[model samples]
Target: MKVSDLDVPELLDVITKAISPVIFKGIDQDSSPHLWRERMKLHAEIVGRITAVLHCGDEVGPDIGEIIEICTRNMRAGYEQSFSEVLGPGGSLSKIRKP
Candidate 1:
């Protein structure tokens, strides 16, 4: 479906789903601190670009900022959950090592 066809809430869901998997996959596959840092930088740039586009669009307008915030929070929560699952209790990205 076209992005234009989606409402604000639907757009948030679509964006989160589309982006979160890539981040989770990166977290899972990154074998070194440098790789992980680079991947995260790229991800941040992508998300920033997307947010800028959404903010400029007449359809999203003023609500875009809040939507982006919520989307980011959801993505962070998903990352933390994935890390916890893979690393067990008290697990965090800092504890991840090449394996």
Candidate 2:
């Protein structure tokens, strides 16, 4: 079934479980907001594919959390490294005057 067919609670549970690890990895580890945004975008893409796979297959073997965990664990194996540099670590954009 499509995400539209899911109840609100089911959708929330699926989305939350899919993205929770990314939040923890980004927030608690001091990862940049840019990286977090990319992670969220990747999550939406992967989850959509996985959900479609489930819909097409007759398998009901895994819970949503388990499936998400498997997908993320595998995806991370091929993730490329990228860095985000903050121009002013703690300063507002308006406060950073060009020299």
Candidate 3:
């Protein structure tokens, strides 16, 4: 099924359900301020990657496995760059975090 085939709510529901476990797992693994920032960065990277893939008109099969495969493949790419861009010296995240 293509992402466009799903209604807004259904798309959100499916994406949230699919991504929640990963978010929760990261949350469970760390509670420090630095790790919390890392987790949030990772979450943003994941959602951004998924959105990019969907936007590119990729085909997703009905099976959950296929959906996961797509998500995994997209999520694994460019993360280090994204992480550095967000958390590096003078990154936007630092500006936002500062009062």
lDDT of 3 by residue, 8-99 (tens): 45565588578757775744322444775566556656665565556445454455455555655555455556656755677654443322
Which should have the higher TM-score, number 2 or number 3?
3
Q: In model 2, where is the ten-residue run with the lowest total lDDT?
A: 79-88
TM-score of each: 0.43, 0.36, 0.43
Candidate 2, superposed: residue stretches over 4 Å from native = 1-12, 15-19, 22-24, 28-31, 57-99
Clashing pairs in 3: none
lDDT of 3 at 36: 50
Model 1 lDDT, residue 89, Cα: 40
Q: After superposition, how far is residue 5 of candidate 1 from its true place, in Å?
A: 9.6
Give per-residue CA lDDT, model 1, range 1-99, as digits (tens): 655554755665587579867874845543554555555555655665475555454555666666766655554555445544635544454465565
As a TM-score, model 1 comes out at 0.43
Count of backbone clashes for each model? 0, 0, 0
Q: What TM-score does structure 2 among the candidates reach?
A: 0.36
Model 2 Cα RMSD, 1 decimal: 9.0
C-alpha RMSD of candidate 1: 6.0
Preferred candidate (TM-score higher): 1 or 2: 1
